[model samples]
Target: MSLYGGMNTAQGSNSCLCDLRSDTMTAPDGAMRAAMAAAVVGDDVYGEDPTVTVLESRLATLLDKEAAVFMPTGTQSNLASLMAHCGRGDEIIVGDPYHIYCDEAAGASVLGGISMNAIATQANGAVSPADVTAAIKVDDPHYARSRLLCLENTVGGQVIPLDDMRAAARVAWDAGLFVHLDGARFFNAITALGCEAIELANYADSISICMSKGLGAPVGSVLVGSSALIMQARRNRKILGGSMRQAGVLAAAALHALDHNLPDLERDHANACALATALTEMGAGDIQLGSNMLFFTPRDKNPDALRIHMADAGIRIGGQSPAIRMVLHRDVTDDGLDATITAFQSYFTKE
Candidate 1:
């Protein structure tokens, strides 16, 4: 429908117009671009960007936190929050599959000098409270001080249950460890859980909510927490070279998305379900259909073969080990989904 063409051809057969590689692959629409163009700019380093301030404030209110700071990326936000919460040589308990552990380049260990202690994560992305308890270091001078507990919601798009979050929080509170949430796909989690964003935020000392993902902002994330935590994160952000001179333009788009786009996230989830179901019918592979993400192990495990096949057809998907990850986002339309489904069906039905 609105195929604002940026088609990059790949060497295969036919291709669908939909780009489901990752939400990060989404391009800001014309309205978002227009908002960015007309945005009031200021030096965020001096706290002078009116638009950035408003966006931060609004995010804080939505996340039910005392304050918020806009970050250039969710990775930076997560790293800054971790740095703000823990001291050097401190350990943080986390799920083995957490973005901080797997996706992010061990920033806590290399940059912050904080150690990560991984606990076995359940299929739903929740770490056992017993595992968290066992992971906490005792008051031994020989051990790294366990100072934080990290959790990821919608871990790879599978929503961690609320009770699991509460249990993890209780375990962390009992051990005097601050809890941090890597809520990169938090909107998906909130929509899936049928709860307010704060319901998840309340269990953690801080949250890193991504604007560039499901929210449809071109780029940016927001870290929300107590005023002190955010102030600390601000300094860490500067240290990490994340302080922007004219970030309000980006903030404006995030603001637009919060008002106009947040309500439509459920549609993306629906699209994901439809696509997942259709793929299952086509015998694509074993699919983990959760939230707005579908992780499927292709019947053909050759990554290069499958990637080249899909690319030739024009549908871009994220290749993650044995699983081919297809994410539904704000820009991918219903028509696009239908096209994607048909393309996959045709591919599988062929030799």
Candidate 2:
């Protein structure tokens, strides 16, 4: 793709710097490409794609879900999940700054007519159960029906505590609302918690797991839930025009990621910790470290200068946000970390 489209042309950017932008920046290596080439393809719209079928089933078993469906992107997977769980004019309660709210361009509202009620998240990224209880609308036509509770894991790089999730899910479930987990960084959270995937997945009725991020797949996300819910999601996928014809090519890379890249997640987390320590020692401003992500503001408070400095040093960090984020993934090598640290050293005048 890059050869034809020039999407990933070195242009000095890929050759020189480490990209601390996002985990989604990973590119498929030769082995993953080989797997994609070797995949047995079929029309998935008719449910005949064996590779897609295997990938979905593999994820379902991993999270102990009854079924799973592959989607082109996490946003589509999440949007379809919302549509599957809620009817028109229904409400979804989620944490503020969560992907479903701040990102994804409000597809649930724009496309599905589903409304969102966002609760301010505490420092650790867990919504207060008391706040969730208050956010539930009373049974009245005056308010959109509160139908689902959406939560995210790896909130700010730390796993949301299991007890907090249980408390909040209980509140939503007791109120007759379904639960959905946006686990775009699902494996990162599980790896950080050192718990079985089912332990975290058990909190939600449906789960969206993205393989493109951190897991090192070039593309693909899987939504897992009960058979009936997945059936509904499949219908919604068709409605959303996400139904694919020969997606096994993408699924094959995802399967390879699950097999080869997942075990490397903890290494990414370790790299994050190491980077955080180096930056903190250098007095990098306001550092927030989590599993495989670090958010920091340079002490000079000039992200523009810092970004340029790192770019010159051959390290690509994130945007000009007040607290810039740097993500560590399987594609980020030790040399990349070293270059990033050296760039920061020059920025901080420590060297």
Off by over 4 Å in 2: 1-13
Candidate 1 lDDT over residue span 1-351, tens digit each: 012112344322123577787877677888998999999999998899999999999989987889999999999999999999998989989899999988788998989999998888987889999999999888899999999999999898899989999999998998788999999988889899999877888899899989899888989999999999999999999899869989999999999998789888899999999988888888778899889998888887765566666656667777565787888988787777777877787778884
Give candidate 1 misplaced runs (Cα > 4 Å): 1-16
Local error of candidate 1 at residue 293 (angstroms)? 0.5
lDDT of 2 by residue, 101-179 (tens): 9888999999999999999998899888899999999999899999999999987686798898899999999999999
lDDT for every model?
0.86, 0.89
Residue 298 alpha-carbon offset, candidate 1, angstroms = 1.9
Winning model by TM-score: 2
For candidate 2, the per-residue lDDT at 128 reads 88
Residue 11, model 1: Cα distance from true site in angstroms:
9.4
> Which lDDT value does model 1 have at 269?
93
| Model 2, C-alpha of 145: deviation from truth (Å) | 0.4
